[model samples]
Structure formats: structure tokens, C-alpha cells
Target: MRAGPLVVVGDTLLDVDLQGTSQRLAPDAPVPVVDLAAERPRPGGAGLAAVQAARLRTSRETVLVTPLADTDDPDALKLLELLEAQGVRVVRLPLSGRTVRKTRLIAHGRPLVRVDRGDGRLHGRTGLPDAAAAAVRGAGAVLVSDYGRGTAAHPVLRALLEELPGEVPLVWDPHPRGAEPVPRARLVTPNREEARTLAATARTARSGGYAQAATDAAALRARWRATGVSVTMGEHGALLCTGDQPPVLVPAPPVPGRPDTCGAGDCLSAAATGALAEGALLTEALEQGVHHASVFVAGGPAPRGSDTAEAEPWDLVRRTRLQGGTVVATGGCFDLLHPGHVSLLHQAARLGDLLVVCLNSDASVRALKGPGRPVMGQADRARVLSALGCVDAVMVFDEETPTALLERLRPDLWVKGGDYGPLELPEASLVRGHGGQVLLLPYLEGRSTTRLVQRAHSEGGEER
Candidate 1:
């Protein structure tokens, strides 16, 4: 299910998950006393869609045009950084104000409260940069996630859409605050509530006409002049309507247990748009999207978090493999992440569905590079690596070689940077013996950590 060239345009956000436990109640108030321990940050909304679609590896190229305000918010920078790390080409539209950020306080694995920061004035420039428009024009399919941020309402985006080629499939996730599509969208997806409003606004439907899903979808299709309309019904599924055809009732697969539904819609739209870009029929794309959404919900925060707040285990490899996607593994010291490291990681992610980075522990790094090395602690290194979008999971291994870990995970592919395997490489043999492929990426010239360390030492720097 390889996708062709694809583009995703819309709001970009930083989704921060704060995890901890509330064991005691406050004396002054009834609120539980929570001891916050850790936080996880992920790209949200349009950014997330772009990343997930890229993970499908359906296309030779995928690009995300997102408004990124120039700011010093570390978390926000992290969000944008991960997009590229996850292998999605980025066209950054400058925003004058701060980017939107959503932070949640969670007890166990569920969100207890959410705190959103940022004024509604996230727009700066009025039009898409020339590079952005060209990128969209070249895309096989375009997905728009209008989260009511300014990107969806900008003149440049609207103008571009108005002039876009009709053959380019457009999957639009509409929001109330966003501009309407240019009457030629391939599909528009709105939640039940949003659809009701759209139906009422259409005025063709009498009062309370939204109750009839078909009528509402039809009303919206006509109102937006889109080719098709699908109204997502949270628990039930979606009502898909195209032209004169009777709307099909697609039942979402049942989940056995409670799963996180937070970003299910984004994932659904992303998957479907990618499928559509690859020339899947509308029905086929919808079916695939529905299944992808269900699986995502079933796999979400139901059991990932813990009181200890430990990172996900390597054991998830088996689960991911079973789900049928490429899994890539890379082993390295990763003492100080450099440009070359970033490039390697992004390339690695483009090669697979998920990438597992096997990080060498402090002892192992010390043994390999001798004492007075690493510069950064193992925990620090792992934390930074985990923040990368391309590096889906990071595991600290104490062994000198990742051979044992590779044997355990048996990834679909193994990637290493630089070209030095000599006559025989042990890890290569391990990976190849398990019916897996191995590849070596070219090293970014003059971008090694050792060179930087040496430069620092020459500049009166000491081994910390």
C-alpha cells in the first residue's frame, strides 16, 4: 500500500502528555494531590496526520506545510523537529504569534485535565510561501486538517485551493473557524456535531434534519460542493455518501477494551488520504481508514503507562510486526546527536513503519570508546533520542553489541550509518539470518561527534 506523492496542510500543534498519580486528596480543596513525574510530547493535528501518513511509506515522498511561529518554546521546537525526524518533508510557513500547544494532566494512562495555551491569533503571513504552493501543486493527494488555526483560514491557502488542479484528490477535515473548500473537494469529514451545524447552515434541511445522517451528509456535500461527504460518528462509525449513491453504513470494528480516542480522527483521515493518494477507490480508502482508526483506538493508552513511568519495552516489536509494518532497528552510542545523526534517523524512518533505536548504555559506551567519553549520560542520551519522531522507541542496552537485542526483536530491516563492515559484520549476519535486510547510509561529511569533541577540546574544553 505504497502511496504516491502526498501533501498535508493545516494546523500544527504540540501535544504534551503529563503523567503521574493522584493518591491523596488536598486538605483545602477536594482536588486529588497529584505528584507529576513525567511528560511525553507528540505532534498533533495536521502535523500528526503528516507523520502517520509518512509512516505508511505509501509514497515516494510526503510533505507537511504547517505554520510554525518563530519562538523559543522547547516543546514546540520538539514538535516540528520530530516531523522531519519522522520522515515528512516540511514547508514551514512563518507565523508571527506562538504556535498552539495542548497540555494534559494525566493520572494513570488517562487524561484528568487539559490546559490549552495560546491566543487565537496564530496567523502572521497571509499567504503560502511559493515553495509551499509548489509542493501542494505537485502532490498526488492533499489532506487538510483545519483545527481552527489560522492556516486553514488564510487567503493564500484558499487561493491555492481555488486554483488547484481538479485531479488532485483533496481530503478535507473541516472546522467551524476554517475557510470552506473550493467546491471541488474529493471528500469532507466532519464530526456529527459539526455536520449538524453544516446541515443547518445549508438551510435545505428542515429543523432538526441532522438526526438523519444521510440527509445531513447529503446537505453538507451539496453545501460544500464536494464530491463526497462522510460524517464521523464517534462510537458508531461513519456515514459515507457520494453523489446519488445511497450512503453506506460502515460499522467501526469493536474494541475489546478501553483505548485512547484522543486523536483517532486525525489518524483516520491521515490513513485514508494516504490510501486515496495511492489510487485506492474511495470505498476501499474509507474501509481502510475505518480499520486503521479502530486498531489505533484499541492500541492507545489502555495499558502503556505505568506508575513507574518507564519507556515502552522492546517487546512491542512483536506486536508491531504482527500488525504488519516494516520495523527498523539501529544501534549506536548517540552520545551527542548531530546533523549527520539526524539525517540518518530521518532516512531510517523513511525506510520503515517504525524505528527502534538500540542505545549503548554508559558502561558499553565507556568500554567501546574508553573512559572520558560519552560526554552525555545514558539516560540523557536516551531521553533525547526518544524525542525524535523517526526514533519511535529507544532501548538502553548494556551489551557491547546489539546482536542479542536484534535477535530478540528480529526487525524487518537493520540500518547503520557509514560504510565500514569489513569482511564480516556480526550484527549484519544476525539480521540477515532472521530473514531481514540491512542497509548502510552514507555518513554526512565532516559531521561526526568525535570531530566536534576534538574541536571543543582544542577550545579549552575538558571532558565533563
Candidate 2:
């Protein structure tokens, strides 16, 4: 939502991933032995939705409002730090006792076991006594990500139902263990199984299919007084139901190779919430949610990592181009990443909808800078640059100039650091011929990569 901030209220959690290979069965137990090789930790539940929503919004601000379980809770502290590092504004409620933590052990790229700990304990329901109601009242859109933790029960539920402004759109990812969302919610999204369980809870009996799913969604919509409900039917797609309207079928886009859809639902909820915040209508938001979920599941299957965002640039670039979004391209040896490079990237990103950094391939860098010039390999450079929030995509080009890649991409904007004048740019004519504007961003003084490299060499000699 570009209009105003998106406020998320729900239980926050920490998700940890233990990845390794398992070949043999354990002697002591029936479970397989998982040889842990890597560990990754990330924000989960509402915290995850906040990050997803923030990324989807691109230019809009997102605020996560939740209560920490305890002051000394390691997960809680880590969650705060992670959110802060990702540029999300967090308004934590009064601390209760413990933050929820979920640890998953995976072997051979599949999860073997999951261990969950901590209680979703928020101190009180006084509408998040500190930052809850205030944020809800001022939010452009609000999302309730109930994870069956104690936080989304009666008190906090009522506070949210009462405090959130009437005009704000609300999307709830309902959990049976949690209290029902307000009837005024724009949409209540539940998976097919959850929808079936909810239907049985409502004492309604029928079959389970796309047809039955619509009926079930309608029943829940009526029960909760919500305007609509959509049941996500995995690969079968999603069934949407609004008051007296026919069920709209949103097909799931195909994902290549093995599908990792663990967080697809969360991505849908986050995308829908952002669209609603941006004032999208019910049908539009639902469709947008489905499309985003497809994109997410295609790239993002891991639970505790942003590996999905590091997908092939071609796919993302084509998608952005198809959407009629502005595409900006810039290139560099990127031998050493410094604040000046980051500044130029940030500014380039602001000039367009998507920023693509055409990194120099290993051979290209070696050709341009001589031997021992590139301190890192092409892959390492691409990985480091891809980690930046401003750089949407990174691709390595083998050519000395990015003219060929720019010609293929036909970028709407070609951005260069201020160090280069218009005539000094080798690819300026090609970009201009393609009707692309060549913009030179100011380079920060005393931030040259060559200077940094020379200084390091001089220092090493001094020590010798």
C-alpha cells in the first residue's frame, strides 16, 4: 500500500533452520540421523508477514505491532534486530514472558522434525496498551496473522476489532486456536484443510472440492460477518466467495522443478494486505494475492532464508517488464563494495521500479583490471550486491561494456556513477539509441575503490 503505513498485529516468532544431510537411521531412536551443517534464524509468523508486506509495498512504510514475551528472551531480541536490519518499523507491546520459537531440522532438503517452544503471551488486551490502538487507528490497512498463540485470543482480538478504523481494510490468516477475526474483515483466508475444519466447527456438512470450498468459504464469511472468504486449495488453486457472488477461480501458476510452498500462504496474506492498504478492491486484491503467492512459491520455498529473492534476474526482469514497470540498469567491476557504490545503487533504485546491477564477470573484471585486481569472484560479487535492498536483481556480463546486456534488456534508464561524463561512457550511444535515458548520479568524494585497494597495498608494505 503506497498511501499509508501497513500495520500488522499478531504473534511474533523466531524460525530457525537446521540444514544438513542424513543417511543412516539413529541407533538410539527410530528417527534418521541429521548431520547439522548450517544454521539460519529468521523472524516468523507476524514478523514474516511484515517483511513480505514491506518488500511487496516497495515504497510504502510497514509497521509491525506486537508484544514480546520476555525482556531476556533471545528470540525476541533477535526478532527485533532482524526486523530493524530489514528496515521495518516495529512497535512492540508490553513484554509478557516469552517469544515463540520454532526450530526445524531438515535432512536431504526436506524437513525431518520440528520443535516448537515458548508461549504467545501478551500482557493484556487493552488494545496493545502501548502502541496497538494508535497504530491501528492510523494505519491505511491492517492484517491479523493469528498463529494460535495466546496473543490473538479474546482481549487482543477485541481490542483490534474495536480499535481499528472502520475504513481500513483487514485481512486475517485465521488459525483455529485463535479467536475469530472481526466480521468486518475484507477477507478471511484459510487453507483448504483449515476451511474444512472451520466448516465442521460451524456444524456444516458437505464434500471438499473447489465447489465445496466456495460453499465452505461462504459459510465462514457469513459466520464472521466478513465480506468475503477465500479457501486456498493448494495446487488446485484458490476459491473466492463474496456475498451472493459466484466463486471466482484463481489458478495457481506453475512453478518449475520442486515446489517449495511452505510460505506461499503468508506471501498471499502479506500481498493482499498491502493491496488493500493501497485501496485495491476485493477482487483485485484477491487476484493480486494469488499472483504474488505464485511468484513467491516459485522462488521462496525455504522457511528461514531469503534465498527466494536471489532468483535469476532474467525471470524477474521479464516479469517487471511485462508489468510495464520501469527497468534501470547499471554496471561495474564492483571489485570492492563501499558506501559510494551503495549510495549510487540506492539512488538508481529510486529512479525506476526495478534496479538491475550488471556485474562484471570474472574474466571481464580480470581483463579490465589486470591480474589480482578483482578481490572476489563474480559469484561472490553478485551475492554481495544482491543482498542490498535497493538492488532488485544482479547479473554478470562478460563484456567490457554493458552495451550488449543493455541492448537485450532495453532498459528504460541507464544509470552511471557521477565519475563518468556523458561522452566518457562507452555505452551511452547504444542506450540513447534504444530510447533509454542515461543519468549520471553524483559520486561521493574519497570513496574510490582504487584508492581503497592502493591504501591496503601500501599498509601491507609498511608492515613488511
On lDDT, the candidate that comes out on top is: 2
- Candidate 1 stretches with Cα past 4 Å from truth are 1-4, 120-127, 201-211, 301-464
lDDT (Cα) of model 2: 0.77
lDDT, candidate 1, equals: 0.75
Which tens-of-lDDT digit does each residue in 180-299 have in candidate 2? 887688889999988888877443355676667877888899898888898998776688898896888888765433454667788788888888877788778878888778766644
RMSD of each: 17.5, 16.1
Query: Candidate 1: lDDT of 67?
Result: 80
lDDT of 1 by residue, 133-220 (tens): 8887777888998897777777767777767676678899988777676678887888777787767744444543334777888888
Clashes of each: 3, 2
lDDT of each: 0.75, 0.77
